[model samples]
Target chain A: MRDAVRVWVLPAGAGPDELARYRAVLDPAERARAARLAADGLRDRFTVAHGALRVPGGRATGASPAALTWRRGRYGKPALTGPWRGLHTSLSYSGDLVAVALSEGRPVGVDIQHVVPGGDPVSASARFFHPREARHVAAGCDQAVRARRFVRLWARKEAAVKAAGGRLWPNLGMPVDRADVVECADPAGRHRLADVVAPQGCAVAVALAGQEPYAVECRTDLGDFR
Target chain B: MLEHDVPTRDQVVERLTVLLTRMLRPDAPVTEQTQLMDELGLSSSLGLELLLALEDELEIQIDVEELDEDRMATLADLADYITANSTAR
Candidate 1:
């Protein structure tokens, strides 16, 4: 049987009083990382993202949000350390959204980007994206359309690389197929990538192994947890 | 590839040193033995950005996989790789 992938989205910003409640769930190391950030907004985002990670992560592992610990890989990919076996996870945040992806039996990564206008999508694509992706983004009829396309492609690659535990630098030149569903090669194996339909103004994606028709269960109403 | 000559080791080193200093660490010592990640705290995105700059400056295309941990360990290693891969000046 194929494993299912779950994506949870939480609001990125929080008031100071609420931020403290979320901050309570993080370990000392996470708290330290949050504290080290120079900007209060960035600090709040880090606290909430890390804290939100615990909710789905704990649910999948049957551990409390505060009880979960993380061990980073050689490439610095964070993984659950203790008894939460068999669950793979990834997280990403952009602008107003923090997304967490969880899967069983396969590694997973999620990426979401808020598409801002006036940024040179074609030029940005040429610099950072694979030649094929650059061409694809440029093929869009207009600037706004192209920018949106570029973000989708960018999110796909980011999510795939995160899932593969691969470096983004090398994979920047790695070509992904034009189809919505594509596969990216990693040292370990190939990972399946998919474009996620996200809320307006954002592009989201999830990457994992296997070809099964996995369902994406998304929840935006995570206010109670915070 | 014929349009531009492969830069010499010293040339590559000099250019890389300047690039790293400007983009990654300013007013810091950059040597062949300097670790990109451990010493400079460069993230994967930044590492890729560096690679892209090198490609642009050198007029060469380097596969991202080629810049694995071993190849990107230090400044000299990348210089050697770039010199070997680039068209001979």
Candidate 2:
């Protein structure tokens, strides 16, 4: 009956050496998963450095980070296996920051972006953005205008799709612009989509399914792991 | 799908400007051409929030298709679209 979403913000400042040190602490299973992620060009050092902090924040009770096994679907999205059932989680990295969100009984997705002035949000939108979203970005006259709106919309859509447990392909037929709040009715049931604004310079969002009051807990500290 | 009477061009612009000012950070100065994201730092979710707010305040339904990038690039564009399309009921 507790439906609160817990969000943990991990400092991104950990360097390569620091990440390696963290990796040494991981149990065999987590180390293997970290290796797989690294094989995919997801830096092991960064993932370990950040993932180490996020894994514990879940407060998975008797669970340990290294004991958790991860499985992925065709889209390369990762999920924890074994004892970690019914709990949804997501991870995002931006610069020196790694963010993770946890929700029980609902899929969760999170994204963070550092706003850089005069970035080409329009071009980025066109490549990965939906037609409607692309058109929306195109409306902006300058890079700065387009980029800001582009990233915001991008993060929202990505988080929604991620929460739904698959890429947004055939489902794109649905008009995203019409719904202020969207619910993804997967075979597993309904998932709620919501957005959260991180401290300025950062944008974040969460998707939760089921009938539960939405609550978010965010922290900028990673000192708990040390 | 909007049900309220169409607002005047100036009225729409004024109202939208006020909303933008409030939603965006105090330091961010929104202009007629200010892009919702770049200038105002609004994400897509916030954009939807703005859209919903406008719909609620204006008592009109804004078709998602109508709110394309070109029409939503500036406050002037959004205001114009609202004024031109709002119902006259």
Candidate 3:
């Protein structure tokens, strides 16, 4: 009950000047990561995400936005380092939204996904998700609801994996629909997951690493990108 | 589905490239070395769609039990595994 995760939702859409401002704060490594993306849209989102994600991390650690340093964990999860090493953070970008969750000591992972209209989630769930999860997804009344459930379950799994800094493939079959807080063995930890409020058509979930209850503080700061 | 001869590795690679291009609509050419998840932004669900599509396109069955980061990182890596593991469906 003592843990608290502060999450910030930022708009991923940026104009040329806005993109330049975000890129200006990025370190050389972040710039290189963004450059490797081929598509302009993908590259722009990456730039904005990495730059904007640092805001909450800096604020939590009392460091300047430009002073936060990030390095990839063994599994490619972005981790705070240097002066901000004590603060834990994770980020996810979906469509036009980027969500970042930060906590003082508990490693946090946040996922925001834009559910595609008319995409088939049943087959995807059957093929990839846990048996119980697949059944839960299929239980949805219609395709629309099924897709929403599919992405929600997916966000939970991904957020959990990100919290443990574990790989996603092996944990795909982890049954998350059973309860909000599930015991997972692959990560060897308890994942407390909650669905955060998001824009319509977007599914958002945040995972905190522990069995104890925690509070999620959500902040919307679209103005940061502008 | 009709049974057919197992496609050679090169044939698999060629068709896989076409499939990747059509599916991804990528900015650059989808090469054998292209990173599927990173460059293409392939989600786990989309990744399944791809494997299913590949099975239908090639008329083969891929033993997905072996599918992991080691084999799914790039087009070439996937093609190699598919060539070895697939059977006429």
Candidate 4:
């Protein structure tokens, strides 16, 4: 059977009661990381995101949420430590949205960005993006137009980096052809990219390390598990 | 490739401090001795982000051959590499 790339999406604005419930699922280190966040909102989001990570990870690895050992990848992406080492996963969030991606044998990455009407993708493109990408983003006639383009590229690039086990800075200078269905910068490692179906004002993308068609599921409501 | 004149230690540090403070940790104090891995919490990804920011600010391309975990151990070390490799401007 072709392993499907499973995904989970949750809101970052769960109330204190909901937050407390999800917080129970996180391990000691994750709990401590949540505590280190200066803001309650940030803490709440971290709890939800990490808590979501545990659900599928637990199901696949047969490890308890608290007992699942997470080892950091070269770029700080987390992986299952020990015998369940073949599994791959990635997580990301922006504003009130959070996302998690999982695959059995291939590395996977997911990114989500909350799009704003007046945000300046043009300036951002000029500043840090590759010259080729910067021009493409800048080609948009207005702020609203460019903002959409910005989130699309940002989400795609971030997903690519996570899939490759690399970092954003080095790849920022590398051009990503938005026109291509799947942009693979590394010849040795092939990848596939697709945009996720999300709510209004949100741009999301998932990148997987194989060319095989993946069964993509957009789960907007995971609060029932809590 | 031709050799380029290295920047003064103080110049590199000054530029790096500005870039780091703005990019990575505006709240935290940055200095030559600030540990990139421990203190600043620069994972390989964040380190690459900082290098890109540095490259953009300094208008110089960092050679892949010059970068390694050992050489980028601290803010000072990164500054030294930037100074040594950047072209004269």
Candidate 5:
């Protein structure tokens, strides 16, 4: 079978009952990690529900969650450690939404941002955005125009650096202004990255360094799994 | 070969002042002695952005190593370096 990258987008309404169904599949340590996150209030039922959705697709082998260890590089970027060498995965959460990215042979990163009209575009652009990007935002002629452009740029750059598998500083050398749709050639190989727009003025970007065209599956029904 | 006059130091400084004022939103004049970080609070990311802008605007390749804090102390200093280096090329 050909290895394929899968992206899963969980809807805003996913809840606890949906998460309970996957408990049986999780190894003891994975369960423990979920419990810890829940206790700390860093996550709740919805977080666990989406995390469960990612479990089977992670391609994790063995009986223990410890088998799914991750190694951290210099800048604290994390990667899976094991026989799953080239496989890449990442998960992101905002408000009630959760998104995950998986690829067979290259690092993958994904980001989603909800557009807030009349937001502070300049400050956001100044902190995480490229200089030319800030100029683009500033030239938008009005508030709504600037806010939309700012979120698009923010999502694109964050996803790109995450897939680059290093510190954000190293990727600074790459031209983010020309990054609208990039096909980056790195030491590992070439990879494609593109942005996706979600309904309700949301911006999403996904980065994949694999052979196939990227596909995104948006799931609004976690109850079906239950 | 046709001769093209190199950009004068004053011209380079003038362009850089506008770029810096627009990007950094600083009120004071950008001078040779004005420290970029101390005066304008140009973070590392912004410094990289300035380098990229200089590269694209002037069509010059800036060595990353040359942009250390000491060399990039002021707007005029950066403009001077970019003009000198690009003209030499």
Candidate 6:
């Protein structure tokens, strides 16, 4: 499973020691970006996310965690460029968790959404999601369940578009709540999407472009991430 | 739902904030100067949903064909585009 999609997630609410340890791996630019965020919570989340990114990027590219630099791609997503371009990567965040995914050569995309406590999922799904996905959201037993279903479907849709390097507005209507393999009617490309195990109150999805089968390996432990 | 009335920029931002708060339930206050895509982390799909809701509530038609995400840096920027491009359907 060497080429399996590698995913790592870390809880954003970490102690000072752990947070600083992760912060050390970030470059000056990333640290500056983090500092520019006004809220401490947001700053911490950004730190953890970039740190987690560097750890896997290091392992994937065989470079020091601090040595890797991500350049903005066509869609403005931070992607590995130059020497590290060979390793495809994507990152996402929710309320209190962040995730990073890496693939050897295939275009990969990952998204995470939190099922936060109060929102108009019924109206939201109806307004935003495809008719098929809206129906799926409506099928949930209650508001919380509906919100969970809604966000999971959204994660899949976002992951698909992210992998395609396509704008999401044009593809939000694509019904992807039914299958692991996202079969959009468009014949332009195909993506394999799966719901990865996420922390409580979060929904995570990973998408990779290709027809060949691949494993989705998730690393749950972050104790020795460095 | 004023179908024929042209909404002012302030009106548009007011309606946008109402819809956004209802959908996202964001903890932070959403001001007109707020970065819709950056600070709020509004996904493009959700942003479209917000736009559609604005169209419905404001009773205006938006030509999204030429919309550029790069120029839509803040709520005010989006409102400017709507005010300039929108017409009664």
Question: Which candidate wins on DockQ?
Answer: 3
- lDDT tens digits, residue span A1-226, model 3: 4788888787887888988988887888788878877888878888888887766555566777777877887667778887677788888898777888888878888888888875678977886788988998999998889989999988888888788777776677888887888666565888899889888887888888887789888988735533
Give the candidates in order of DockQ, highest first. Answer: 3, 6, 1, 4, 5, 2
Question: lDDT per residue, candidate 4, A1-226, as tens digits?
Answer: 7657877777878877877777888998888877755456666888888888877787778877656777876656677788778888888877788999888898888988777554457766776577888898899887777878777887887787778776564565555555323544433356777788877887888888867777777777664554
Residue-by-residue lDDT tens digits, candidate 2, A1-226: 5567777666655666767656655666555545543122244434554465445533564565545566775554567676676776787665455677776666677776656664556544554456787788889887766766665665666566677665443233333444536654332334555567576666666666553557777766545544
Cα lDDT tens digits for candidate 2, B2-75: 43566667766777888788765435466677665334435444555576567657666554434444567567
- Candidate 4 Cα outliers beyond 4 Å, as residue runs: A116-120, A126-132, A173-175, A178-187, B1-89
| Candidate 3 CA-lDDT value | 0.80
The local lDDT score (0 to 100) that residue A202 gets in candidate 3 is: 79
**Highest TM-score against the true fold, candidate:** 3
| DockQ of the candidate models in sequence | 0.15, 0.02, 0.41, 0.13, 0.03, 0.26
Taking the tens digit of each residue's C-alpha lDDT, what string does model 6 give over B1-89?
45487788888889988987887666688888877655665655466667878888988776654455664778888888888878876
Model 6 scores a TM of: 0.84
* Number of the candidate with higher DockQ, 1 or 6: 6
Clashing pairs in 6: none
lDDT of 6: 0.78
lDDT of each: 0.73, 0.59, 0.80, 0.71, 0.57, 0.78
The CAPRI category of model 1 is: incorrect
lDDT of 6 by residue, A159-218 (tens): 887787765654667788777777543335889898899877888999998756788989
State the displacement of the C-alpha of residue A221, model 2, in Å, after optimal TM-score superposition: 1.8
Candidate 6 residue runs with Cα over 4 Å from true position: A183-187, A223-226, B1-3, B14-33, B37-71, B81-89
Error (Å) of candidate 1 at residue A216 is 0.6
When summed lDDT is taken over every stretch of 10 residues in candidate 3 chain B, the lowest stretch is B61-70
